[model samples]
Target: MSEEGLEYLFKVMVVGHSNAGKTSIIQRYTKDNFSADYKTTIGVDFFMKKIIWNEDADILLQLWDLGGQDRFTNLSRAYYQQAVGAIVVFDCTSEASLLHSKEWKADIDAKVTWNGKKIPTVLFANKIDLGAGSFMKDREIIEECCRECGFIGWFETSAKDNKGIDGGMMFLISKIMELGGHAAQGEAAPTNDSTITIRPRPKKVEADNKPCC
Candidate 1:
C-alpha cells in the first residue's frame, strides 16, 4: 500500500473531432460543472485533479484538452509527448466525427509512446443525450473501430448529463496505473517540471450548426 499522502502524477490527453465535447468532459471531471455555450478550443488547455485508488494510492491526473481544429492539429505531436493515456471522443450525432476518430487514433499511435510502446487509450462516444438520431446506431461498428484503432476500451458518454464520465476516467486510469511502473510504498511519484498556463479561446458569435469534423 502507498503511504498516507504519496501522489502519482499522470498526464492524460483528450483528443477528438472539433466540438465533440472533449473540453466539456475535462470540465465535468475537474470542476463538476458543464456549460452548453463553450467555444471551440483554440490550442490546448489543461486541468489537474486528484483521485484516491484502492483506498491507498493517490493519483494526480493532469487532463490535457487538445484543440480539435485542423489548424491546431500540427501542434498535437508536441502535446502528445510523454502522455500516459488518452481519451478519443466523437460526436454520436455526426458520422463524420465518428469516422474522424480513426484519424485521431492514428495520430496518437504515431506520436505518443512510453518506453517505445503505444500509450493506453479509450474511445468516448459523446453526445449520447441527443438520443436515437445518431448516425452510427450499431455498437458493432464502434467495436470494430476500437479493435482496429487499438483502443483498450470504449464508453458511450454524455458529458452534458455527466453519464459514464467518471467510470470511463477511472477505467482508463486503472489501465494506466497497471501499465505504468508503480512507485514504491513510500516513494514519491515524478513531478511535472514544465509549467502550464491555460489561455481562454475566443468565443464565436454564432454556433456552427454543421458537424465540425
Candidate 2:
C-alpha cells in the first residue's frame, strides 16, 4: 500500500493532552504492540520510518513523540515550529482530554502565526476499541473542538486493536508529500487544502501619499 514515484522527506509532530493514547499509537505504529498498562511519556521521544515512493527517494518520517504533560506542553511548541506535519491525538474515553485539543491547537498557533494554514494535521480519536458511549462522546467533543480550532483532518482509531492506525499515519504522511509538492512549486503552501487557505495582502506604503505642492 505504497504510492508510486515519490521521493520526499518530512517531519511530523505527535501531540495531544495527557493520557490521550499518544504513546500507544506510536508503539502500535512503530512496534506493532499496545499495552493497557503503558507508561506516560516523560519529556519527548521520537521514532523514524522511511516511506518509499517508487523506490526512488525515501521520505523519512521523523515522528516527534511529544509528552502530554501540562508542564511539557509549552516546551513542545518548539518542536511544532518547524514540523512539516502533526498528529493531534485524543483519548476516546476522556471528555476532558478531548476538550484540551483546543489548547494544543492554540499552542501551535501561538508559536506560528499563519492564517488558514492547514499544517498537515491528523486528529486521532484513539481508544475506539472501547466501543460507543464514553468513546463516541469523547470523539464528538473532539470533533467539535477541531471544527472550532480549524484542524485539517481526523481519523478514529483503536491502537489496542490496531484499527485505523496505519491508515491514519499514511494519510498524514501522504499529505506531507502533497505539501512538499506545493512547497516545491513555490506557491503559498495551504495550511490544509480542505481546511486552511492562504491569500495575498495588498502592498502598503510606509508614508502617506501627498500631492505634489
Candidate 3:
C-alpha cells in the first residue's frame, strides 16, 4: 500500500487436474518462457507478475499454482483463504480433464469469497495448439461448460506456444480489478517480494489484447 502510486495486490489461485498445464500457464505468463518438462507443483508453488492495469493503478498479481493431486487438496485449501480470483485450467485434449474443470471451481467456491460473495473465476482450455481441430468442434460444449460452471469467461490457450496466455490472465485480472477495486483490506499479508514495479511487458500486437501494465 504505497502512497505514491495506487499499488494493489490480488491473489489468484490456479487449480486443475495434474498435467492439465496449470503450472505451464503460470510459467508462460510470468516468465514468457516455456519448458516441456516442468515437474508437477508440490502442494503449491507461487509466482508474481506486476502489471500496470492502467495509468490509474499498478497491480501486483500473486499467483498461487496449486498441486493437482488428491493428497494436496487439504493443503490447497489453506492457500485459498484470501484469494480474490481464480483460474481453473484443463487440458483441451482430455475429455476427463474438461469434465473435472467444474470440480476445481466448486472446490474453491467453498474455500473463499470476494467481498462476501463467490470469487471471479476464469477458465482456460490449455494445449489448444495441440488440439485446435477438435477444439473448434467442441467449442459449443466448452462455452456451455464455462457458463454452467460459473466462469466469467473462457479462453483457448497453449502455454508451450505462448498463445492466449496473456489474454486469459488479463481477462481474469480485469474482472478482479472491477469487482474488488483497490481496498487496503489485507495489506498486512507478507509477500515474497514487495516494492514491485509494473515493468513493461513484451510487445503483443493483437488489438484485442489489453495494454500491458
Candidate 4:
C-alpha cells in the first residue's frame, strides 16, 4: 500500500556469464539468504521485490534471472523484453567473466528499449569477499570497460555477505526512475516484440573452466 496511491512496477533483468552469481544476488536480495550449493539456471527464472522509494512511491521490481550457459543463450532475448533496467553482473575473481560481461551488455542493448531509448544499466562486480584475485584488478581497466559498455555505474558486491547489495539496487532503481520516466507514464514494452532477435555468443573452444563467482 502506498501513501500517495501510486504504484510503479519495473522489469529488471540480471544477466552475466555462467556462474557469475546472478541467482545468488537475487536470492540474497529478495530473501536475504545465500546458499553455498551451486545450481545452474535452466533458461530463465523470475523473482519479485517491493520497495518504497522516496517514502512515497511503491516500486515493484520484477527481476528476471537469465541462464548464462551458452546453450541457453538463444533464449535470452525473450527474457530481456520489456526490461526497463538491468544489472549486468560479473565475478570479481575471474577476468574471463568480466570480459564476457560486455557480451551480456551487448545482448541487452540489442533487445531492450523504453520509449525509443536504451534502458538504464548497472554493472555488479560480485564476490568481492574473495579479496581481489581477479585478472582485471586495476580500477582504470574496469572503468574503461564500463564506459565501453555504456554502464551508468558499477558496484563491488558480495551476495554471500550481503554487502553493497541493497545500496547497489537502490542506485539502479533511482537511475531507472530518473531515466525511464516514460515507462511509468504508460504500459511497459510488450512481452513479445517482433523486432527482437536472439543473438548468442560464439561458442568457446575451452570447456571445464571453473564457474565464475
Expressed as tens digits, the lDDT of each residue in 64-141 for candidate 2 is: 887887434466655665576778888777767777777777766655533345476778888878864454654456
Question: Evaluated with TM-score, which candidate comes out highest?
Answer: 4
The true-versus-predicted C-alpha distance at residue 106 of model 2, in Å, is 1.7
Give candidate 3's whole-model lDDT. 0.77
| Residue 52 C-alpha lDDT in model 4 | 65
Q: What is the TM-score of each candidate against the true structure?
A: 0.81, 0.74, 0.81, 0.82
Off by over 4 Å in 4: 1-4, 70-72, 134-136, 182-213
Question: What TM-score should be assigned to candidate 4?
Answer: 0.82
What's the candidate order when arranged by decreasing TM-score? 4, 1, 3, 2
Model 3 clash pairs?
A: 52-213
TM-score, model 2 to reference: 0.74
TM-score winner, 2 or 3: 3
Candidate 1 clash pair list: none
TM-score head-to-head 1 vs 3, winner: 1
Q: Each candidate's lDDT (Cα)?
A: 0.79, 0.69, 0.77, 0.79
Error of 4 at 71 (Å): 7.8
Indicate the residue-level lDDT of 138 in model 1: 77
Q: Which stretches of candidate 1 lie over 4 Å from their true place?
A: 1-5, 70-73, 132-134, 182-213
> Cα lDDT for residue 84, model 4?
78
